[model samples]
Target: MSEKILFVFEGEKTEHVIARNFISHYIQKENKTVIKISFCGEIYQLYKKMSEDDFGIEFVDLFPLLQERDENLKKYKRDDFSQIYLFFDYDPHATNASNSILNELLDVFCQETEKGKLFVSYPMVESIRCYNGIEDNFMDLLINIDEVAYFKQTVNSYAHKKYNNVPQWTINIWSEVIDLHCRKANLIVHSKNDFPEREVPQDLILTKQIEHENKSNNVIVISAFPLMLLSHYGEKTASILQNLA
Candidate 1:
């Protein structure tokens, strides 16, 4: 039987796009469908995009607060679901937005169904950095990223220095991470919209909360094991997804 799973996150529409692809790839099951729900704005558009694919998912825009409530006790119970998954980043936002979301999930779960399980994937930046062989002290790795003028140059440099060539998946992940980081830098350097106070020094985040602060640019770290489990072991991933669903 198919299960209903909820994925809540604090990113824009693109995050959902990547998540759907990731979940579809990870589950490796075409028949056992999942319902992808989000709280991000413009749910209708996401629903349209989700419908276009044969990923076997029904996407919805749920209220962001659902994560905090218990699935069993709520007035509108989602008892069909075996589990609920919450994906968010512990980025350097003063608002404690991630914790607030977590609290909501806790409130619901404790009140509704003790049987329900919650999975939290966080610090996406560290996840990507780890995949790309970037050190935890990523400030040091910045030199390498900045020096890679071209892929060929990177490869040549890798050969000269005997640095391992990054895997294709790692490269893709790094591309996203780097793009996010650069964009965040631009945001700080250019505008003062979401970030009002002076941007915290990168050195502080890089040295102490490198894993924690990656979310500042939407680059929260995630466990590569989840990705690997979904991609390499198709049959097992299917079983896991089925159970979770």
Candidate 2:
């Protein structure tokens, strides 16, 4: 039977494009199918409307939510997918940029096999490939909250010319991106200046970034796309990332 993975994306174009490159390069399963669904609104808005009895985000079923916003998801069932992954941005400028809300959402959606795993791209979805042409050592890269709303424009102006079309990225280019983000995730979470040795939970990364934001008011530059690839594909992808170093 073919393994089916459902990708729920907030930034439809960017997330799907980046995911396509990674999926095409790293996913070797001959019988694997990827079903993509895009959410048109901010995740915080979803949290606000869906809070439960205790004003806590207890139940979040992405299938129904996706169906509510997109008419195409009416036929898909939750059980049909082997795994479910969600990709969203950390838009701190939003009116509902509360740490508690994001933390609760992260806690509830922690399991990929069950409820689904949520991966957040710090600041915005463009962080996955917002590598500036001049800054090679971007592990310490941090962007202020005030400037976050304009991040997509910054990426358009500063990111390497080649990254303008992420969907066209070759395997070698994808390998480089995966390698860069894997190491950056380690630095952001564990404060280690090396590649991640083991899988670090997305919630942990979120917690740390939240703490950092409280203190410094700047969010680290890390993307959920590469980490998602590393988590799902494991060492098959890691081996390629490691060799690139």
Candidate 3:
């Protein structure tokens, strides 16, 4: 049997397009693993949907005080997927006001970390574009930065306008960019803290308030997509990435 992995992304268009292309290429090359991708609109919407479906937790239960049932919830079985991953951005909800909801979602996700992973990109998904052999400059750009402004001026500037049309080519460029970034930095394993204010604590512990929470080793938090990609595909993939670069 082939290994099955399901990815829930925050964006419907760009993420879905990129994931489809990347997974298609990956499947063609490996021919053993199967991947599924879905978009759940925004991060908050995705969180609500995953909580209700994957964990069987209701929206009211997510926030006992707030009574809002305007949205419909879906049902999900654990056996539906071998692994589940949530990809989201850290910029919009990094402030103190949004931290409560963020922490709540994190608590829910951390419950099944062994079977579910949370992959967050700082600022936004476009930050991955910064990985084109300029590790020092990329690192410098991240220091003491205004998340919104930086994203607009720098990250969004590199956003591929034709991403939806030619996702394979876009991802190929990303792979090469990451390969160059890793080689230039001389790092075998990239640190998860490469993104500012987005580190998953090594000693993350769950509180007792959540009844459904469980101790799990499944959650794999990452700041850079290249690290995850290279690690998953191995050094041979790196050789291919270099040639593409």
- The lDDT for every candidate, in the order shown, is 0.36, 0.77, 0.44
Clashing pairs in 3: 113-218, 113-219, 114-217, 114-218
RMSD of each: 14.9, 2.4, 9.6
Residue 168, candidate 2: C-alpha displacement in angstroms: 2.4
Model 2 spans > 4 angstroms off: 28-30, 52-56, 133-136, 240-245
lDDT of 3: 0.44
Model 3, 1-245: lDDT tens digits are 66555565666556565566566655435544444444544556655554565545433232121112212113334464455556676554333324345556665554222445555554456555543334445433431223343654554354345322335466566564555434422321233323211222211311211111223211111133543354355556555655644
**Tens-digit lDDT string for candidate 1 (155-195):** 34332221222232332343343333433332333432222
Name the weakest run of 10 consecutive residues (lDDT summed) in model 3.
Answer: 64-73
lDDT of 2: 0.77
Model 2 earns a TM-score of 0.90
lDDT of 2 by residue, 1-245 (tens): 77888888885576777777576655534577888888876779767666743544565456786788767678888888888888888889998787778888888888899888888888888887788644455676788988998888887886888766688777777777777888778777787766676766787888888878889999878888888877876656577665543
TM for every model, in the order presented, reads 0.38, 0.90, 0.54
How close to the true structure is residue 102 of candidate 1, measured as C-alpha lDDT?
Answer: 41
Backbone clash total for model 3 is: 4
Q: Top model by TM-score, which number?
A: 2
